[model samples]
Target: MKYEVVIGLEIHLELQTCSKLFCSCSTTFGKEPNTNCCPICLGLPGSLPAFNRRAIELAVTAALVLNSNVQLKSRFDRKNYFYPDLPKAYQISQYDQPLAKGGYLRIETDGNYRNIKLERVHLEEEAGKLIHSGESIIGSDYSLVDYNRAGIPLLEIVTAPDITCGREARLFLEDLRSILLYSGASDCRMEEGSLRCDANISLRPSGSDKLGTKAEVKNMNSFRSVELALNFEARRQAEILVAGGTITQETRHWDEEKKLTIPLRSKEGSSDYRYFPEPDLLPLILEDNLIKEISAALPELPAARRERLKEQFGLDSSEAALFTVNRSLGDFFEEAAGKYSDYKNLAKWVQGDLLYYLRESGKTVEEVDPQQFIELLALLDAGEINRPVAKDLLNEMILKGTSPQIMVQKKGLGRISGDEQLLPLVEKVIDENPGAVENYRQGKDKAIAFLVGRVLARSGGRADPGEVNQILKEKISRG
Candidate 1:
């Protein structure tokens, strides 16, 4: 019997606040171990927690972006647990009264869009990092705890089991990350551990509403890892069910080296945490005007931006989606398009050549001047320089941060478009390749392309290709 894979994700995002969630300790990463700790963050005696106002504003902004219903009065609760990374013995998190709920994120899958329902988006404090001596934590002889990441503000976004496959799970996260970055909430860097995902996956009989026993998989650091882990877990569970075996309800760790899931321990439920309302902090009461202010302050989200890019700039869906993923790149395209009349060419250069060099040179759009870029495109449009010359000049511009006109003048890379200079080169090409000239005269239209390439090569890529083609055809027809 065929089975259906059901997956849900609990994504944790570290907020971009300057301080910790409940303390004034620095939230900076990569400091000396435990250097950023304080009494409040360390949970020392006689210390009390105070919430950060900036964290709250950013959390509310995330909720609004996801279309979540913000709770007017939300309170924190103590999640009782014992772990080496948890210096406080219990975590202060939201239980029944989360900050936001009942939201959705729409993702495109298989050429159609589907809304992945969100269960909640809550705020909590991050746990410290555990540095193990060995490669695997399971076989580590010793471990060290770093409190630098402790008390960092975290936003937990829990989604319902709306995802049907592994690819869909990956796409959902991609779109979600774009939204988070666009909102300036978090950097969502997987390598830095700023954005993490825990997937709960199960396999049930096709067309059945009853949920199967799920195994929560952790340690997936990247989107590709998440998709691969979910796929492996789904297949593993399905194999067990088909063989008349039962799947154990446990927590599993994704072994990246092994490329499989290993059983860690039994899964825990809400009762296991022994949650209760915290008495130290007061219930949060968000005002109406504050919500309105946040809603108004929100910039254009990814979906709306995608649509606008397509309609306003005449970009196809894929091209628009590509540009809109990075706000700066999209802004660069718009700025250059405003200066140049050809939107399509501007979009092509920004998305194609600009992105390529930026990645190769480890630079950003901020480092380059948009007006100078438009000037370069204008030069190409006006036939002042050919495409090859423009590309070389663009690389230099990206490296040295110089203007296109200055670079062109310094290198003497002007286009040889004058018919007086091109006709002789065209004649040389026609005389050198007698066979091609004969083929062109015998009605083979493609032979002229070979002659044009010869002329361009003789000019050292400085000749205008259109002019070469025109001259080559005129010379060939006259003979």
Candidate 2:
């Protein structure tokens, strides 16, 4: 019997705030361990918690963007747990009364769009970071905890079990990151621990509505790992069911290096947390006017902007998707499009050569100048420079941060189109490769291409390829 994979994602986003959620401690990353701690964050005695208004505004803004219905009143509860990383024996988070609920995000995969419903978007505080002496906590002889990240305002976005496969999960995450980045809520940097994800996956018999026993997978750092982990877990569960064995519902870790999942511990239910209302803090109340202001301030999200880009610029699906995810590249392309009418050519260069050079030179889109790139394209179109020269000039423009036109003028890297300069090179190529010339005379149409390549090579890629093609054909036909 075939199996169907069911996946639900729980993502944690660290809000971009200057201070901690309920304390005055610094929220800056890369600080010395234990240096950013304070009485409120360290949970020392005689300390009371205070809410951060900026954190609320940012979270509400994100909720509104995701189409969630922000509640008028939400309260915090104590989530009782004991771990070295969690200085506060209990974490202050939302339980039954969350900030918002009932939203949907549409994702596109293979040219088909589907809406992934959200379960809830609640606010909470982050736990501390654990440093192991070895590769991981399992094999390490000792572990250390740093409370610098503790008390930072965190948003937990939980999704309903709507995903069917690993690839879909990855696509949803990519689109979700783009939307969150556009909302200005979080940086969504996975490497920095600003954004993190844990997936609950299960496999059931095909065409059955009853869900199977799930194993929550953690330690997946990258989007690609998310895909691999979920797919691997699904197969593991399926193999168990196919045999006379049962899959144990437990928590697992994605060992990125081994590229497999390892059982961590038995999974915990909500009852295990022993949640209770916190007496210190009052219930969060948002006036209607504030919600209206936030809703009006919402900017264009990724999905709408992607469709608009396609319609406005006549870009195909893949090109539009590329621009939507890489907002800086889209901005550069749009600004250059204002000064240049060749939309197709501009898209090609931005998506193809520009991206390639950026990866090779360890440069970002911010370092590229829109005017310089357009000038390079314009030079190529006007026949002032050949393709090879234009590519080299583009590389220089990115690396040296100089204008392509200035570089061309300084280096005398103009097209060699004059017959006086090209004829001698072409004649030399003909004399050197007599076999190719003889083949051409014998009516071998492809032989002329080799002769042209020799002439272009002799000119150090500065020769006008079009002019060489014309001159070579004329010379060979006459001979």
Candidate 3:
């Protein structure tokens, strides 16, 4: 019997706030261990927690972006648990009264768009990081805890089990990250641990509505890892079911290097947390006026931007999607588009050559001047320099931040467009290659292309290809 894989993701995003969620401690990353902690963050005696107002605003903004309905009165609750990373012995999080709920995000996969419904977007504090000296946490002889990440504000986005496969899961996360970055809510940097994901997946018989025993897979640091881990877990569960064995519901860790999921422990249910409403903090009351302000302040999201790039700029869906994934790159393209007349050529340079140079030189779009890039495109348009020279000049400009025109003049990289200078070289190429000339005369049109390449080779890539082709066609036809 064939089976279908079901996946749901619990994404944790650390909000871009200056301070901790319920304390005055710094939220800066890469600090000395425990250096950013304070009395409240460290959970010392006689300390009380105070919520950060900025965190609330950013959270509400994110909810609005995701189309979630923000609750007017949401309260915090104590999630009772005992762990080494939790200094408070219980974490302050939202239980029954979350900040937002009933939202969905659309993802395009397999040439079809589908909406992945969101379960909830709640507020919580991050736990500390655990450092293990040995290969694995279970094998470590000693461990260390860094509380710098503790008490940091985190937004938990829980999604429904609507994803049918691993590829869909990866697409959803990519789109979600783009949305988060566009909103300025979080950086969503997976390497820095600012954004993390844990997937719950199961495999049931095809066309069955009953959910199978699912496993929660953790330690997936990247998007690729999430997809691979879910695939492995789904296959493992399917094999067990096919062999008439039961799949135990447990929490598993994705061993990325080994490409397998190792069982961590039994999965915990809601009753295990022993949750209750916190007494220290009052219920969060969002005014209607504030919601309206946030909604109005929302920028054009990724989906809308993609569509606009396609319709307004004449970019295909793939090109538009590629440009809009990085907000800085998209802004650069838009700024250049305002000045350049050729929209398709501008898109090609930005998406193709500009992106390639940026990656190779270890630079960003901000490092290059838009005016300088526009000047380069203008030079190409005017036939002042050929494409090869323009590409080399672009690389130089990206590396040294020099002017494209100045470099072209200094290096003598101007295109040999004048027919007076190029006619002799075109004549030389035609005289030396009699076989190609004969082939062109005999109706083999591709032979003239060979003669043009010879003329360009003799000109050191400085000759205008269009002029060479025109001159060669005229001379070959005359012969």
Candidate 4:
């Protein structure tokens, strides 16, 4: 019997805000351990909570970008739990009244596009990190707690079970991340855990009417890991059912090193943590004008930007998708496109030479001042330097933080425009190499390559190869 896998995701994105969700404490990452914490964010007793307006605006923008319906009223609920990392022993989150719902994400997979429905988008506070023992993986002697991230605003997006396979699920996540980043709602940095995912997966017979019992998979720190974990769990469930065994609903941990999923506990045995409404904060009500303003301010999402870049900039779909991944790279491409009419050539050089220099130097596209890039492209367009020398100048500029124009002046890497400046060297080489001259006379046409090489060596490679080829062909014919 054949089976089909079904999957859905609960993605928590850290909202890019200046302050924490329930307090005025700074929400900056990589601060001195717990330096950004305050009484409310630290879950101190007698400290009342207040919501950050910017966080709500970002959530609204994110929902709008996802095509979600923004609710006029939403309230926060208290999710009670007990963990070493949770100082309050309860997390403040949304329960019945999420801010947004009924959205859909469009992802291209398996040579086709599929729409995945979003159940809801809610606001919540983040939990702290857990440090483990040096020798043991699970056992802990003692762990230091940093409340710095405790109350950071988060947007939780839950998906429906419309995803068919692991690849489709991964594609949906990538598109969602792109939308969030493009909307300026979240940084969506998976490596730093600013974007976290928990997946629910189940398997059933191809023609079955009932949905099989599902398992939740966690500890997927990357997009690739998410796909792998889901693939493994689906196959595991299918194997169990095919062998006439029952599939259990449970929580599983993805062992990335082992490339497998391990069952943690059954859903029936899991703690509820008892969700309730918070009394400290009032319910959030959105004014229609504020929602309209945020909708107007929302930048073009990834799909819209990708389509526009393809149409306006003459970039192919794939090339446009690559260029639109980040705002800095997209801006750089547009600025360079403004100076050069040849979009194909500009795209090749920007994606190839420019990206290479930036990655090798460990700098972002934003780190390179636009003036430096503009001058480098200008030198190439003016024909003052050849392609190889231009690449070398780009490397120097990246490494030493100097402009390509200044480096060209300092190194005298200019074109030898006149043969009067070049013929003398060509003559010396021809007289010195009589055998090659004899070969050229005998109709071995490639022998002209000899004169070109000799001229290049003598001219310090400053001579243009086109001009060198012209002069060499003339002298070799006379010889």
Record all residue pairs in model 4 with backbone atoms less than 3 Å apart, i.e. clashing.
Answer: none
RMSD of candidate 4 to true structure, Å: 2.2
TM-score of 2: 0.94
Worst 10 residues of 1 by lDDT: 470-479
By lDDT, the better pick of 1 and 4 is 1
lDDT of 2 by residue, 338-375 (tens): 99988999999999999999999999999888988999
TM-score of each: 0.93, 0.94, 0.93, 0.93
Model 4 Cα shift for residue 265 (angstroms): 3.2
Q: Model 2: residues >4 Å from true position, as ranges?
A: 427-447, 472-479
**lDDT: the better of candidates 2 and 4:** 2
Estimate, for each residue in 209-265, the C-alpha lDDT of model 4 and write its tens digit: 677789999889899999999999988998898899998788898988799998776
Q: How does candidate 3 score on lDDT? A: 0.92
Error of 2 at 452 (Å): 2.7
The CA lDDT of each predicted structure is: 0.91, 0.92, 0.92, 0.85
When summed lDDT is taken over every stretch of 10 residues in candidate 3, the lowest stretch is: 410-419
Encode model 3's per-residue lDDT on 26-117: one tens digit a residue: 99999999899988988898999988999999999888888888999999999999999999999999999999987999888777889999
Model 1 accuracy (lDDT, Cα): 0.91
Q: Quote the lDDT for 68 in model 4.
A: 91
The deviation in Å at residue 58 for candidate 4 is 1.3
